[model samples]
Structures are given as structure tokens and as C-alpha cells.
Target chain A: MIRSVFFVSDGTGITAETLGHTLLTQFEQVSFQQMSLPFVNTDDKVEWAVQRINRAAESDGVKPLVFSTLIDSQLRTHLVKCNGVVFDFFETFTGAMEKELGVTAQRVAGRSHGMGNVRAYSERIDALHYAIQNDDGATTRDYPMADVVVMGVSRAGKTPTCMYLALTYGVRAANYPLADDDFERGSLPAVLEPYRHKLFGLTVDPERLHQIRKERRRDSRYASMEQCLMEVRAVERLFKRERIPFFNITQRSIEEISAQLMQQAGLTRRI
Target chain B: MIRSVFFVSDGTGITAETLGHTLLTQFEQVSFQQMSLPFVNTDDKVEWAVQRINRAAESDGVKPLVFSTLIDSQLRTHLVKCNGVVFDFFETFTGAMEKELGVTAQRVAGRSHGMGNVRAYSERIDALHYAIQNDDGATTRDYPMADVVVMGVSRAGKTPTCMYLALTYGVRAANYPLADDDFERGSLPAVLEPYRHKLFGLTVDPERLHQIRKERRRDSRYASMEQCLMEVRAVERLFKRERIPFFNITQRSIEEISAQLMQQAGLTRRI
Candidate 1:
């Protein structure tokens, strides 16, 4: 049966989406049509949102599940009557927190993920620029300033890892593509010598790497299984020889890759 | 006084971080030192994590705050004994969710942000590749396939918006930079004409755009306040004239920008 789920929030709705998705994943049997309704702050907006949720409930003959983080009581009251199973995330926990800590919440929207701190925003933007500027070994001029440099064979999950680290943690991450030249020489690139300490390697299963490469450029030497195996083998050998920490991304997600990399590298998130 | 906050989880700890930070932000009176400890599944790891929390509590002279998403009973028991005020996330809501949904949780870690579905993982990776290939007015080769195309002047937050849409929602988002050449002509670029329906504009405050540009290229005419104002005004006029939805990114986070764009574009996340 198809079910409807709404992540309703007065701000970005990211927290509602993240938590709601996590909770929904537990019920693997149910197929959910999920949508996010962000910036639902006003009475008029909440009334409109309620009608939308109620319509979904009527059409499905089941109450749509709403996971909400709206802090305003008036807006929340409107949601409670939306003919849906409302999960009041902020109200549920914030009450307990106030009682436990003996301090009331400020009850403001967007404080969690807003532009509250200009410095933090700039740090993230700076990290984003760093990730783009140094992408795929484009430049090594600022290697010394990089928090970490990820090296991997093409399409082996390097670029996204760097981007995730930069965007999520405000970490200055750069990634380099471990090309055929490096594999042929059986050594690290000369440019990476000075910043060897900042190096983190990524290796993927040869079969998976082949699958990924085939998507980008079909029926080429780059997408061949033999080439994938050779590059992965060379990278692993170099990682072992240099004692640089590395990971295999064949079965891991970007979050897992970045978390493990940060742990292994002892790089605390700048944010 | 400095207080330490720990985001402890069985998975990547992102959920804990997001929720915990939201709670902490309410208490603006205190300064927090935040750290994430992900993949805390084993009893040994939990024990070690407890020690770290205790050390932080000892050093800070104020009980540390532990925001945990550990689903395992054994881990939760260990965490309760730690020298901190524990906020158990899963325990707080999972029982209620179980009763409401009539399904017991599987208690799986990393399901929220993991490689649970191979198809979803491949989709995300594929979209990411598409975004990188079609970034910054790079090409019109695959414009027909893009879920959305973000257009704006340089440093108007086009690249990250495309990347976020791609990475988070598995939307094949391409970005085109609306350069001085496109503006002086007083119309849309020739490449973007066919994909006008997929276009979303990002406009930043001229001052912020100037600051951002100055960082990229200091002391250049491109970074001047006059140049920034001229470009922003022209882009805004174009957005209005063409009836393309647009946003000002001066005070919004990337999360905010992406969520609003998804809403405006009516783009359902592919994942």
C-alpha cells in the first residue's frame, strides 16, 4: 500500500526530513511518497499546509504521517488538526529538555541551520572553494593549507567524499585522481610528496569500479576490468607502503566514508 | 564557561548531530565544544566513548551533554552510566512510532544515510557525475536530461545549490553561469533557451557577492562593488522578465536554498 509522509517545518525542514526518513526506513514493508513542506511559519501557511495534508489523508483513506519541527505553538496547533498522525518532534523533546535542564527553549526557527554565524558560513564557503579548486589534482599550490587530500582511481568515490566533508564539516578537503601514470610508475605523484601526511586513499572493488567507469565512458580501456584491477591494486599497495589511511567505498556511503576518514585522519570538523 | 557536547551514534552520527545542535542552539547562554563520535556499536567502543565523555565532563567542570541515537539496549545502558546528562533519541520516539505504525523497529544503523538500496546509491552517484559534468555553463550536451538548471552570476551560489540538489535529492541538476556577456546582450543565453522551463535563478546581495568575488580574485574589476551591483540588478530583471523563480541567498543557508528550490521546482527527489 502506498503511504504519504510529510516533513513539515518552519525553517529548512532538513531536521524533519533527516529524522523522518530514518524513522520511515525501519518500516521497509511500506512504500512512502515523501515530500517536504518547509517555511510553514505563518497561520495562513499552516492552514494551507493542513488542507494539503488532509487531502492526502482523504485520498489514501489513511492519515498521512507528518514529522514536524515547527516551534511556534499557534502553527503547531493548526498541524495537530491536519487529519494526519502528527509527530511533534520539537514539542516532544524540547519539553523534556526544559524540565531536565531547568531552562526554557528560545523557541526560534532557523537557529539550528540558519546564517547565525557569519564566520561559520564563510568557513563552509571557503571549504567549498578549496574542494573545487583542488579537485582531481587540478592544483597543489595550497596543499599545505588542506585539511585532507583524498586520492582514488577515477569514479572511485573521491569527489563526493571531498565535497561532503567540505559542505558538512567545513573541512578544507581536496581530492586527486590516481591516474594510469601513477599506477604505471608504482609510486605516488611527485606533487603529493610534501603533503603526504595529509593524504587519504580510497580504493573500490575492481568490479564496482568497472561498473562506475562504464557509466561515464562506455567500452573504453578506462572501463575495462583489467584496468580497474590494476589501478586498485596499485593504489592499495601505495597506501600500505606509505602507511596512509584508506578505505574501500564499494559498500559504503558518502557519510560513512567521510566519517571514517575524519576519524582516521584525526581531523576535527572546523565548524 | 565552556561546555562540551557529544553526538554519539551507532551509525554516522549525523542525525544526532543535527538534532543535538538544534537543542544546543536554544541555550544561547552557553558556549559549546561539539564533536561527533560515529559508528559506536561495540560495547568496547561505547565504553571508550563513555571515558571520553567523562574526561570532557571532568575538564569542563560541568556535566557534558550526550545526545545519542544508539538503538541497542546494551549500548544505551552503558551510555546511561556515563558522566553526562544523556538524551536518548531512539528510545524517546521509537516505542511511540512502533505503537503508532504497528511495526517494531529493525534497529538497523546507518539506514537513514547508507547504501541500503543499491539502486538509490547508483542513482545518487550518477546524478553527482551529471552535475559535475554540466557545471558552470560548461556544456549544453545533456541539458535535456537535467532535472533543473540553476543560473546566476558568478559566486551567486549556483554550484553548491546544484551539488546539494544532486547529492541530497538525487536530482540531475546542472548550473549555468550568467556571465557579463550574457547580461550585456539582455537576454537568456542561447544554450539555456531550450531548457528555460528547468531554470532557477539565484541572486545574492551585491555586497555579499562582492565580498565573495573579492576572496576569489582580489583587487580585480570583477570583484568591484559597482560590477557586482550591475550584474545582480541585470540578473534580477532577467529573472522577473522570464518568469523564472528566484531567491536571494544573502541570509539563507545552502539547506534553505535547496529546500526552497525543490519546493518551487516541484521536483520530487529521485531517491
Candidate 2:
């Protein structure tokens, strides 16, 4: 049985630790641990980690499973003497991104985590996720309670992102829908008008929306490819006319999107 | 075979979707999907959920496996007609808590996840699992970018709780030893001094600490009952003179401790 697991990251160990903790919840028997060597992008940290692993092997007889997000291979080699298994997140993701984006990611500048600001994107994305899943009509009552609200059409990943916000930030998030009918009428949804400043928008390509919707409703008009295209164009136009600041969520993971919004919204880096 | 799974809490479909998506990250073949009924909490939402489940069953021609968390039993029965196995967390936990705490729980709260604040707690503890396993010092500069340090004798759950804080709040946490030698010195390890306000103390009864420590290190003076009492006494006196707000993490899980600490420190929640 796995007694322990470690999460390592090349940058901040933030993503690795979060995902690691999440995975550990499924099992009750194992203990979880984390250590981040932020500049693990360096040879020094890698050698240091390997030395620690060597010492652990000498004393702590237990085998530990290491999950890492190091973008460098040399550091991983340093940990070779550690008496356990090692896993990397940036390793797999870089390969995937290289294949998909058709280019290697340039070493980022001065640690953005792909971000320039903190709370703005954090708070907004959190609010957006909150809005998408506000099923109890709770969003209506949540206005005063809300730090932000996100509005958009179907399959825009409103709910999941919002929940991430609420779960992560303790920010009360409320999302509103800009349905086909509402779009046709050409204005923000009635529920959203009163909270315009708090109302953020999410947009995605129609192709993506249709593909997601198709998984649920096979032949329905809402799920059809052509209709999805029409909806996207309509929603995009509506958001533009309304001057709502929106994001194209095609390339971003839920994390990146929320992070970006938090930066945009001026929320501090509580992350 | 299970094609997909749904993990939901209360009326928000988005929160369930966030969990479902994260769970999906752990698997390669299962099709992870999500649905929500955010406005319907109390008894009404349960029946509505059952109707939706039934409809999904008809469309998929498979009994959908639902990991749901609806607190109302009357509504849970409605889901029984759906041709799938439904797992409700509250259904299990409420009974367990009622038995353990000797009281009934009222009001279904956020995401209605049976984990609730424990959800945050689990996330933190899980991070600790990763920390020990990985152990590269550079983690200090990573996403958690933790500067605050926690120090106490072992088995006080310093590792797990730090991971929880790091992953949950993005606090880069580092812990140092407060062993006999350090105690004799009557001062914190030199490295922890620069981050004093960020320094939070975690102190528990030595007897309890000894019992827990014994599981990891057998028969050592550090793990003996008498020694534990001495250390506990010394640390309490040290903390009082030095003035560190600490919690006795004797009986509580990492989550309970984390919740108290987060509230105490006035730290903002991290998604």
C-alpha cells in the first residue's frame, strides 16, 4: 500500500499540490505530503532534492510516491536515489501542449503562473463559477453577498468555474444565462441588469459548445452543430454590444481561466 | 462498466461539475459529465433530481451512477426510479455524525458535499502527503510561495496541515523541528525567525502526541509517554512566553484544525 505521496512542481508546486491533495481524498489509508522547490527549474534544487531522497532512503525505510511538475529532466534524475516512484505534471503537459500547440512553451518571464495580477482574475473567475451553478435562485439573493457575478450562454463552463471560485475563494458567485430567447430580445438577461458591474461574461467557439451539448442532447436544436454556431455568434455579438468583458475559454483550463479573470478583476493573490 | 460519474452537492450543479471534472483528471477512460439543479434545495430539489435521473436513464439506456449529496430523504427516494446506482454523501455522513456527535445536523450547506469544511481540510491534508514525498526546498518559491513556518514535535500533523494550507490557500508553508535539542535552546530554529507573524504554532498534548508518534517511530524517547508529556509541557510554556496562537490538534482531523486556524489567522480562503 502507498503510505505517502509527494507533489513537486517546477514553478510553484501550486498545481501539483492541489491536484495531489485532490487525488489523496479518494483513499483513506495513505498520508499525503508536499514540498515545492519553486525554482526547481534550477540544477541546484534538483541535486538538493536528490540528496534529500538519498537521505530518506537511508533512514526512513518507507517508500514514497512523488508527483512533480518540474519542467526540467535533470532535476528528476537527481531524485533517482530516492526509494520510491516519481511522477511529473509539467512533463506530461508540456508533451501534450507541444503536440497540440505545435511548439514548445517559451520559458515564462518573472513567474506569471501565466498571470500578471492576482485577485482580479481570481475573484472574477470564482464569481463566474458561482453564477453558473447558482441553482437555488440563490444567486438572486446572493447579489449583496456576492463579490462578483458571471453571465454567459450554455456550455461556456460557467458552473464548474464558478464552483471552483466558491470552493476556493469563499467568494459568493452568481451566474446568469443569456439564453437564445434572451439573445434574440437583445439585452442582458433581466436577472443580470441590476448587477451589471458584477456581471462578467464567458464565451467559447460555437463548435466547442455544440460538441459539449451534443454529448447530452443528441438531436435537439440546442445541441445541433449549426445552432451552436448561430448561438455563439449571437452570444458573442450580444456581449460585444453590451460591452461586457469576456474571455474565449477555448485554450484555457478552468484554472487558467479563473486565474486570468482574477488578475483582470483585481482580486489579490490569495492563491 | 461505469461510463461516467456525477458528484453533486445540494442544488448547485456547478460545484458537482467541478468535483466531477477533477475526478475525471484522475481517470483516462471514464466519461466524466455533470448536471445541476441549483435552485432546488430542501425536499423539492431531491424529487427534481430523481426526475432528471430518470430522464437521463432513458436516454443513455444505462443506470447512471450518481455520487450525489442531497440531504432530504424524501427527494432521494425520487432518484430510486432511475436505472442507476446513486451515492449520496449526506445520506451516509449525517447518520455517522448523528451517532458520533450525539446530535442531529440541520441545514444542508454549500455544495452539500458531505465533506463541507472537511472538504477544505482534506484538501490541505492531501497537500501534506505530497510535501513529504517530494521534499525539494525550492517549493518555498513555488505557487504556494509560503513564508510562514509551522514548528512542533512530530505527529502533531504539521506536514498534512501545511499541505492543506498550501494547496487550499496557496500559502507556501515550511515546518521545522522543535525536538529536544531545539527545546533545550529555548528558541525557534533560526530559519523561522524572519517570518514570525506568519509563524503559527500547532501544539497538542504530549500524551496524545506520543501515541501518534509511536506509530512512526517505535520505542524512541521522543515517542515515549513520559517524554511526550515533558515535551508538551515545554512547548506550551515556550509558546505562552513567546505568544503564539496555537490549537491542540489532539482529536481533530487536519480539516478541523485548518478551519480553526484559517479563521483565526483571518486568512482568505483559496479555491
Candidate 3:
């Protein structure tokens, strides 16, 4: 049977969604129709949200599963009154924490995503600007400042990986696309010599790389299977020869790639 | 007391980190030293991770808080054996889901981030490409195809917001920077007139805008507080005149900003 899952929150619903998705992934046999109901802070909004949940439960012939991060007691009480198996995140842990720490929670909404620390926000923005400025090996003006320099063939998932690293970890990630000459020479690029120790590489299966390239440039020589195979082999060979750590991202997500990079490279997150 | 908090996982540790942080945020009065330990999948790794956690417990003179998502039962057992208050994510909900759904979980690491759905990956990549190509109003070749077009003054958080929307939600978000001329004209740009329905505006406090621009270009007219106030007031007036919904992202995180944009614009996530 298809289950209806609701991620309800007083703010962005990110915490609810993340925790709910993690829980749902364990139920491999059950399919879920997930919906995010963010910013349900007021009495009227909470009441409206409850009606939606009840409707879902009635239509699906089963109680909907609700994962909530509602910090307000009144709003959370309203949500629990709905016809669903409610997993109240704040409610689950706040009481225990209050007892342990001998203090009460602030019970504020959007505290996690609001202006908790201005310095942290500025640092993240600076890292993002660094990633943008150094994307695709466009500039090496401040290569020494980068936390990690990602190297990969075109369409081997360098740019998005760099962006993800920067945005999520406050990592100053610079990415360089390996060109034909670097592959032909079977060596690292001259410009990357200074930052060799900070390099991380990504390689993909030839078929996947070929498909990705084909989508970017339809039916071109660069998108051909032969070119993809050659590029992948050369890049892997270069990584091995240079003793640079690399990963095949053909079956991995950006989260996996970034986590592996941080662990393998001993990169510290700035924020 | 400053407690030690560990987010341990067999895969990327993202879920552990996200949920642990969310829970910890409620305890505002307590101090925490947080660390993420990912890819602890094997017996040896689990042993090493547990030892590390034990060390932290000893150093802190109290039990560490361990939030884990290890799928393997053996590794989880080992982790719980450590000197910490371990909250096992998978163990907590897996049995309940299995009982409810009448099936065993797949018990796999990195499934959430693996290449499970190729179409989703492709859509995300395409959205990223669109965000890059349309960033800062460089090109509006396919504005009609955009899910949302973000507009703001330079350094008002357009590029990073669009990128977050694209990466996180697979939304084809395009951003345009409002030039001085546009503010002077007191109207939307001629090129953006046809796509007004897709427009979403972002603004920032004059002080915040001044600080951001000062970082980008120090000791310039653009970074002056007077100039920042003038620009912000003009842009806000134009938005009000046009009845365009806008947000002041001076204190909002990218997560909150993206969620607000999606809700306000009624944009559908492509993925």
C-alpha cells in the first residue's frame, strides 16, 4: 500500500523532511507520497494543515505518517490532534534535554535558519564566492587559499561537487576540467603543480560520462563513446600515476562524493 | 558543561548531522562540540570510531552524545557499547517500519545518495547548468523555461540562492541583478517584462548590503552606506509599486530563503 507522509514544520520544514526521509528510506517495500508543509506557525494554519492530514488519512484508508518540528506547544497540540502517526521531533527530545540540562528550551521557530551567527553566514558566502571565482580553472589568483581543488574530465561532475562542498561545508573548493592536452601528456597540469597535495579527482564510468556529455552536446565527437572511454582511461591512469586519491561517481551521490573527499583528504569544514 | 556530540554514519553522515543539529538547536543554553564521522561501515572502522567516541567521553568527563545512522546491526551494537548516549537512527525506526509495512529494509549504505534514479540526477544537472548560464542576467536565452527568475541588487544574494534552489530542489532558477539604471527607471527591465509572472525579488538591509558590497569592492561609492540606503529604498519602492513579493534575506539562511521562494512563487520542483 502507498503511504502518505507529511513533513510539517513551523519554519522551513528542512529538519522534518531530512529526518522523515531517512526514516522512510528504511521501508524499502512501501512507496510514499511525500509532501512538505512549511511555515505552519499560527492557529489557523495549523488547523488547516490538520484538515489536510485527515483528508489524506481518510482517502488512503490508513493514518498518514507525520514528521513535525513544531516548536510551539499550541500548534504542535493541534497537529497531534490530526489523524496521523505523528513523530514530533522537538517534543521527542526537548523534555529529556530540559531534564538533563535543568533548563527550558527557547521554543523559537526558525532559530536554526535565522540569524544565529552573522559571522558564520559571511564565511559561507565568502566560500561560495571563492567557488564561483575558481570554477573550471578559470582563475588561479588565490589557489593557495583553497581547501580542496577538484580535478575531473568535462561532465565528470566537478562543478556541482565544488558548489556542494562550498555551500554545505563552507569549503573553499576550486574545480579544474582536465583538457585533451593534459590527458595526452599523461600528467597533471602545470598550473596545478603548486596545489598538488590539495587535489581530489572524480572519474565516472565511460557509458555514464558518454550519456552526460551527449545531453550537453548532442551527437558531437566529444560525446562519442570512444572519446569518453579514452578520457576515462587517461584520467584514471593519471590519477594512479600521480598518486592522487580519486573516486568513481558513476553510482555515488554528491553527498557521498563530498563526504569521501573530506574524510580522505582530511579537509576541515570552516562552518 | 560543553558536551561532545558525534554524528556517525556508514554512508555520508548527512542525515545524522542534519537531525542531530536540529535537536541540539533546541538546547540553546548548552554548549556542544560537534563532529561528523562518516563511512564507518566495517568492523575495524566501527572499533576505531567507538574508541574515538570513548576518548571524547573521557576528555569531556561526561558521556558524549552519539547520533548514528549505521545500517549494519553488528556495527551499531559495537557503537552502542561505547561510553556515550547513542541515538541509533536506523535501529530506532527500522523495526517499526518493517512491522508496519510487512517487509525487511534493504539494509544498504549510501542508497539515499546513490544513482538510484538517473532521471533525477539528469534533471538536477540540467537545473545547475541553467542556474550558471542565467546567473547575474548574463543570458536569458530560455527565460520561458525557468521555474523562477530571482531578481535583486548585486550582493543581495541572488546567485547563491538560485544555485541552492537548483541543487536542492532541482528548480530551474535564474537570477538577474538589478542595475542602477533599472532602479533609476523605477520599473522592471524591458527584457523581464514578458516573464513578470516568474519574477521573485530579494532585498537586504541597507547595513547588510553595505557590508557585503564593501567586501566585494572596498573604498568605493558602491560600498558607501548612503549609496546602499538609496539603492535599497529605490528597489523596495519599485517592488511595492509593481506588487512583486520580496524578502529581506539579511538574516535568513539559504535553506529558509529557498523554502520561502518556492512557497511564494508556487514553483514545482523538477525532481
Query: What TM value does the first chain of each candidate achieve?
Result: 0.97, 0.55, 0.94
B-chain TM-score of model 1: 0.96
Which sequence of candidate numbers ranks them by TM-score, best first? 1, 3, 2
Runs with alpha carbons beyond 4 Å of true place in candidate 3: A98-103, B98-104
Estimated TM-score per prediction?
A: 0.97, 0.34, 0.96
| Residue ranges of candidate 1 with Cα displaced over 4 Å | none
| Worst ten in a row by lDDT for model 1 chain A | A94-103
Backbone clashes in candidate 1 total: 0
Q: Write the per-residue lDDT of candidate 1 for residues B1-271, one digit (tens) a residue.
A: 7778899998889889988988888878767888889999999999999999999999988788889988888889999999998888888878887776677888877787778789988888788878888988788899999999998999988888888888899999999888788788888877788999999999999999999889889999999999999999999999999899998988888888998899888888898
Give the alpha carbon lDDT tens digit for every residue of B1-271 in model 2. 3343544444433334443333233333344344434434556555666667777767766666575555556656665555656654445334543342234555344322223354453344334333433232324333234545666766566755665565456454666557787679887656555666766778888776776678658898768898888888888877777777786876554444655566565565443
- Pitting candidate 1 against candidate 2, the one with the higher DockQ is 1
Candidate 1 clashing pairs, residues 3+ apart or interchain: none
Candidates arranged by DockQ, highest first: 1, 3, 2
Task: Give, for candidate 2 chain B, the lowest lDDT window spanning 10 residues.
Answer: B134-143
- DockQ of model 2 vs. true complex: 0.02
In angstroms, how far off is A220's CA in candidate 2? 1.4
lDDT of each: 0.87, 0.56, 0.87
**TM-score of model 1 (CA atoms):** 0.97
